[model samples]
Target: MDPFVVVVLSLSFLLLLSLWRQSSGRRNLPPGPTPLPIIGNFHLIDMKNTRQSFSNFSKTYGPVYTLYFGSQPTVVLYGYEALKEALIDHGEEFSGRGSFPMLEKVFKGKGIAFSNGNVWKAKRLFTVNTLRNLGMGRRTIEEKVQEEAQWLVKELKKTNGSPYDPHFIMGCAPCNVICSIIFQNRFDYEDKDFLSLIGKVNECSKILTTPECQENGNQQTIYSLDHLASLVTGLFFAGTESTGTTMRCALLLLLKHPHITAKVQEEIDHVIGRHRRPSMQDRIHMPYTNAMVHEVQRYADIAPNSMVHEMTCDTKFRNYFLPKGTTVIASLTSVLQDSKEFPNPEMFDPAHFLDGNGNFKKSDYFMPFSTGKRVCVGQSLASMELFLFLTTILQNFKLKPLVDPKDIDITPIGSIFSTIPPTFQMCFIPI
Candidate 1:
């Protein structure tokens, strides 16, 4: 045989073996787009907007499908039914944390946000107990958030209707709240140390560490000082970024649609009035404002992919098998943006949460904070922060967009993991 033919045969044999192995591994998995030897379905994915790519896959492959991330086969649970089935119905078996190499490098799987199995359970319990002890949905943390809202309003008053980017100001409120939870104190807006602290949080943040939590921790295995540090950092990053970005997106949407902002303000006036601080008590009476807040989260669609999950065992789900250790991604974008649940989901309408009689209507499709066993730990706290902070801002002043409402763009800056509002300036015209 010719030398070229021999070399070509060797390469062909290797390629065939690689493809055969990939196929054998994916045998019992849900059907999906076919994979090439190494790259797999990566070419089908849009690096900038992976959620849409995965969603697109569901068109042919149905609600559940598999995609290859390099040589690794990962399952994607898209749409409401599939997500509910996996994250809610089969919650435990699907609740194990999945891998993300870059984030893993930073988090090291020691904290609650990244850890799995016994470590996850232990840390999750400790964090939950601490929050409950600190009064998460009750008056304690609420008072701290309300106090911070007043401070946030004070800073806006300083702006005095001048056009400015709200990026940092929007961030400070949530950052301080999480800080108060962790450190038992809040910082002045312009404090030099505060700025430095926020810069670090911007780099990476989360944790509500107390002496009690520290002393209570085992400090022998998963409860080491390192685990505590990662938890704090995870809290700072997770708590601050998601809540702050959502608030900022709320403001942007208000600027883009003044009518919605007006309706929210009108509700604020009717329920809480200008003289009093907005409370969780107001959320019940202020249906429109509450709906608007839910709409903001749904429309903003922040945290698109959510934290990935790894299967705890070889699980049978909806006629398909997810082998033990298989990685799964429940596409949050699909759930939040489902047209069947929210008519014209692409439209930014608070009416999605409103009944025909005008009462606030709740839908099961609202999973902005995600669902099931691994639901965001700060869901209640974050909800309180968003509602209080938003209502307070609208109550104190009106959003004055620098441009015409029609011209103001409300589109989010899309990422593989999150949907963030673009940077823009607006005025906080005192009402």
Candidate 2:
């Protein structure tokens, strides 16, 4: 062969080899919606309503679909089976919570919610045990809730059955409960620092739900005001807004379904009586109320998307490979709205948790708190707060709509990190 011909053939072979390597590198990634260069799929995300948009995307791309937002690759797990498999069945493989550069900057590894590995393990365990020791799931906690509820009732009564916004007042009540558990004290409604903290938290929540922040450019440092702002906002939004919104949803639902409300009141009145306050011990006996609370959680479906979980090490789910550092998000909304599991998922029916004989029935699919190791650290405390605040409020007063029920919009406002909760005026008519 000619020397020139041999050299030309070798150069062509090397060029083809380089192209093959590039194509193979792309193939190694999980399939996802086509992402734009640099931006990825950040443009496609509905930062305002992430759960709804992601749910719609999951329908098109199957349960385990990949999405790129900014430089991060996110694996979304839709529906009960997928979420359960990721968070429970193959939990260890998907246990690590995804760490964003901004989040690291804010948290600086202080709390249970964001920390990972042994640090997360120790913090979460300590937090949970501390809450329990503080009587979070017991009668002592109930007394605190009852005290707050009485104060709220007095405030509502002062409204003289006039229409009023309950969002701010209602929100502060539950945040105070968590504050008592964490800080060993509750905040008065007028306290300056307490109110300032709540304001900061609310602002942070708004920033989180907004799409504007995503355009702020990639941050490298682990701590910055932007990150801290987002972190505080996320904590307040998650800690207060979620539990509060669920209670609001429950109140609205009870008002619309008077018969159910009546039943709950009767049950509460029967077990605890009008003279005394309802206790946590009464939860088992007041099955209807327990079932109703569970239904509220299911229907409200707050935190539709569980916190994104990251793979600390290369892991495999069934045969699907999840590479190290891949972000996994469990869609709680899909699971709660599963038609197969809930029959009529859209309807707000308390019967979903009730048996033929009217006894409370626990369903395996009711996972509002999620599951596995990284499951909500506040689950036990949130449950106690929800049940106590809700039942106590209902026992003392009836939530009467100020206008036609149809005019009272339950549709959420604000961005998607947490439900903004609807704005409506109601008269808390004393029973």
Candidate 3:
């Protein structure tokens, strides 16, 4: 017998035994399509539409199911109830942050979004406190959002009803708001340094998959000065990206639905009027406008998968056991598009958030910033931003599409991570 053949047989036997053990170990996990070793269920996924793939998997596997991203078994909570149970009901148990490889290389497990255990809790607390100090969700922050909204309006006025590509302007407004919060000063839209920074922030998504983690002066470790840079980057990236994308998507949707846009403008006229900018106080009296904002978030459905979360401790949930550090996805797309909660959810209707009396109706399933213990730290800031910016724009200008409203495509040109509106030039016809 050849020794080479003997070695081959031994290796084959060991590999088979390891695979057998892997299959047997998954008995306690919920249930899903069986995964192949190594690549696991990568074959089961459409890499492009991963969230939709996860959502589709729910139809076959029911609400709670297991998937293997490589050898790691992931438990997905599909619909609203399952998500609420795991994320909110078992909040503490599921509070740990999970891995996003593209982000981990940059964050290095040092920041609020990706850090776990005590570091996560501390970082989160510090961030929340820092945001609060910077006037997040308060009247002070409202003023900042309003100021930016005014600046945005002024910038639009410069267009003088000419056709303009608003992509950069839309990004600049929210980016500056975050800049103020993080750096304590906003930049002029034309400033070269500010433009460069924005380029880096937007490029982070495009380039992160192959990101070379740049070295700074301090390279000690987590909690080191190098990590401090990662922390600020994490906050700045998150703060600007989602809010800006939502605003862009919301605007695109408005252009697509001229009648809906008319209604929102009508409400703005009736409540806040042109005399004053929309305020948080105005939000209560302006039910239709508020509903429109909420519906935009639901219908836009950016950040569909939300941030992946992890289990803090080994826990038995429902009939299956999820080990500590098990990655869990509470599908925001599933909850946002849940037909049960919002009738004809695929249609962009403000009535989904409105009642028979036309008052704003709150739905537990509206988790765009997501819900639970680890909900987006800037949720309040984002909400205020949406209302103020959207209303302000409508108050000053009527969004005129070059094509007919029916022809306008509201579909997001999304990447794996977030949604982006198609590149468009529109006439910001003054109201």
Candidate 4:
């Protein structure tokens, strides 16, 4: 072929490419703000700060909206109804976990949390069954939690009414409980390796949620083994930080509302007595305490964007075509805050989980661990830990803020990962 002919062919090819993109763009994806070329809607997205941005986007584009980060098209699901429909009604179709370049390079699909398809199924089943077999919902697990709670109480008592940050100490107790369950061991507070691991987990949480870390230019090419490591890091980080943060939030709420704390303590004292540690069996008799725990999970809503799933095949959602491989985020925060679901979404009221007769009432939208097939694998363990830890601490000691309640900040500071643990000193006055 002559040089002139080759040049003409190249120009024609470029023209066709542009036309093809334009045609494809006309497809009816769920409605959202128009995206700029190459970058898509990324410029408009605040990856660092997602909660408010996601809520605002949902308002303008409806509950289900489409967005583009680089070349990736993501679907954002907000509120209870949309989340339930996508995560539960069409769960299998939306079970594919989308991996960021860094995480894909790191976790290479080895763990239960990040792995998907048949491997994910196998791992998830094995984990859930193993937990159950190990007495997750039974007395054995409760004993472990109570033991950890005792250690936490001792640590708190050491503070001797002095103001100190409880975030790290409170987080570590539950973390150790999970560690004990999984690794079948516990770590001392001063263990260097354990402390290092905790720090790494916290750092990874911040790194994974940063918009800069997810940007096209920022992503590094990671192979299978590297990906596996990244996934493990992510799991450890998510598993520990989220539950720990929520526990801290629970303590904060108790401190801010002494009446609520007193009620829970009264129930514990009457049911379990201070002579022995409280166990799972006591949960049934302690309705008020159980309701308070459920309220903490609901109001905290720690893992705002629980986990991202992808469409495995082309599908129709409410007359809109969502193509295969589109990433979907289930905004758990919205579901927890839904007015129809929780009458007073903003107020931290235990009544949300109680009826007029003071009996425990179940709400369809109280999905702090999320709902559907890919729900939190450690849900049972987390519940046991929170209940035991909170009740145990409250039974023996009172939680009060080091500073005034007005000075305690509840606003979350970081994006993607919200760790809004109150920064106040509190004394554990022995009861």
Candidate 5:
């Protein structure tokens, strides 16, 4: 009878007891695949195709269900109805941002994208107000976008219709736009300092698994330098990568469907004309073009899993109990790809967002930037940038794929956090 054997038996007994309690506790919670003791349902999910995995889980568990990420219970809301219920209808109850281990190290919970409670409320209000003051929805922002689009077009023209990789060029444009908005000035694409900053932003974006937390700063009312850095980093990272990736995906899809690309160019030409740059005002007049943009956001479905949210308190939702601190996800991919809303959701059809009269159509299910109280703060700005940049490029040049349109692969390279488009070079033939 060794002491080590006695201790081992005690530990084993406690582990079994904990597992029993965990199983019994979930009786009133949303049904999900039975999770093991330590790993939980982590094995149930395909790390690569997490979005598709969640979608598959929904087929068995219904729209609202539970899954364990490690030992934490995470409730996932799939499709438009469940998303609307939790995110919009019960917005306040579900407004808490979920914790992330990696982001906590970086953000320390100071940024608007990840902070919750009073910190989130104050920062979000300040950010929204600051952005509005800086002309987010105004002409100043439009001009900045136009200027960047001009820069992008010039760089693209340098390729001279020869094969040139566009990943960096595409990234630079949107990243500079965020720079201009946050710093009140844009940086040269090749400037060493600016390039370094862009590198940091890229790093933050790639660490998608990171969660965030907050602590008190020097001045109670003002954000400390660390907090400010985290805040700006989050903004620049989100503002640049998501929008840039979407634009890249849009171009890739357009190259694949030349007819659709032609239609977009035609609409841009007709509504804004070549003499004048495409403006937000022109968006209302160009239904086909507008629909194309919406379709691109929907089809690309960049941020498949929306930012994680945590419950502030134990909450009863749709007859299921979600405990306090449980992480929650409203799958944008599920909503975007809902076949019930978008017929043949797999196909990249702008007609999904167009009526028979060729007018732009809208759907409650289009939640690419997500919906509800915590929808992306830069949503409007991102929309403007995407529209302006995409149209301006189309207005100036016709994009030609290096390979045959049919041979072009539109599949995203990375699928876990973001739907990163494959590295590609396109011929930006001048019009």
Candidate 6:
């Protein structure tokens, strides 16, 4: 029981532990900041600004590096080169969704967004085919979007040039669109059940919004109550929340840059004419408006890091060995904001998606929805809704910020889960 003996034994044990970790870390895993015993490199993270902190780490450790959250080692993919390589080129090995405690608590890992293995494959195929059958790319879906856009414009007009926050007003249209697809019918915005469902989208818990399902065939038999609940909630969160937030960002950005807004309205008017609502076909002819929507998505850079991807098996990527079940984050923010791909990447410029000839330009790095085999299932539907909703609003209203355009802060508020637009009021005047 000698104190000196105890101290010497403790010191020796610590030395051995450090050596073991060093040997393991250097064997094949990507290099990163040395982690502490339990906390790992969590102390190195700037919780308030996660993307910037990750970018700073990339500067020190190159594009691919490891950061430990507690005992779990998470490999982060930075910039377009690294992101594209892992998510697209080597997709199969990196397609599995990692364990997310909060999402697991809600989804129970049953739906397409968070599920892996056979469950995910079955649900994804069913959902995609169902959406296609429901006319996702056809005029049937476009007509629904146009109808919601009309309702949105009607609601916005009620403000009568008053400065008001458009968050709920913006959200209702997208929420109903997803509702129609999932429940086979849309609810009135004023309906209590509809409002209650919208409020549950952000909660890290199960929602009680049930869809009316009819016994059809093998697919219906496979889809249990849990399956349907998870699917509906997953689609609601993905379909409603992200799309609504992006539209809010688009409007705020337009208000911040009135000249840009003017140009978009002009393009909409010239291409589609004021007498009718915009359509998917019109997206081709209205390059400038299309570019503006692209720019909004790029600038918002929502979902900076993708939902974690687990390595299906041990894989070698970019000359680094990633072990089986290793957690990976494809940083969408890094790709969208890469200066090489986008000149003045921080600036809100539609020219990023426009060619010198004024045509809508597509970039391999425009990955707001993430990419690869696991790209968002609602991609086509969300795109149609964003285009129609935004153009319709612009066609009918002039969004004037209460303050000077330069004074408006377009910097997003939330940093961890999403890069949300700051709260501000704008006067939606009828044109």
| Quality of model 5 by C-alpha lDDT | 0.84
lDDT of each residue in 158-251, candidate 2, tens digit only: 8887888787777888777767665678878879988887786666556554545421222332234544444444446567867877877888
lDDT of 5 by residue, 115-184 (tens): 8777788788878998899888889999999999998888888888887777777789999998888888
Pairwise TM-score winner, candidates 4 and 6: 6
Best prediction by TM-score: 5
Candidate 6 is scored at a TM of 0.92
Top lDDT model: 1
Error of 2 at 268 (Å): 2.7
Q: What TM-score does prediction 3 earn?
A: 0.92
Question: What are the lDDT scores of the predictions, listed in order?
Answer: 0.85, 0.74, 0.82, 0.76, 0.84, 0.83
The 10-residue segment with the lowest total lDDT in model 2: 214-223
lDDT of 4 at 225: 46
Q: Which residue pairs collide, candidate 6?
A: none
- Residue 100 deviation, candidate 2, in Å? 4.5
Give the range where candidate 5 is weakest over 10 consecutive residues by summed lDDT.
209-218
Off by over 4 Å in 5: 2-11, 209-222
TM values, all candidates = 0.94, 0.84, 0.92, 0.86, 0.94, 0.92
Question: RMSD in angstroms, all models?
Answer: 4.7, 7.0, 3.5, 5.8, 2.4, 4.9
Clashes of each: 10, 2, 0, 11, 6, 0
Collision pairs in model 5: 100-211, 103-210, 103-211, 104-211, 108-213, 109-213
> Candidate 3 regions off by >4 Å?
1-15, 207-224
Clash pairs of candidate 3?
Answer: none
After the best TM-score superposition of candidate 2, give how far the Cα of residue 334 lies from its true spot, in angstroms: 1.1
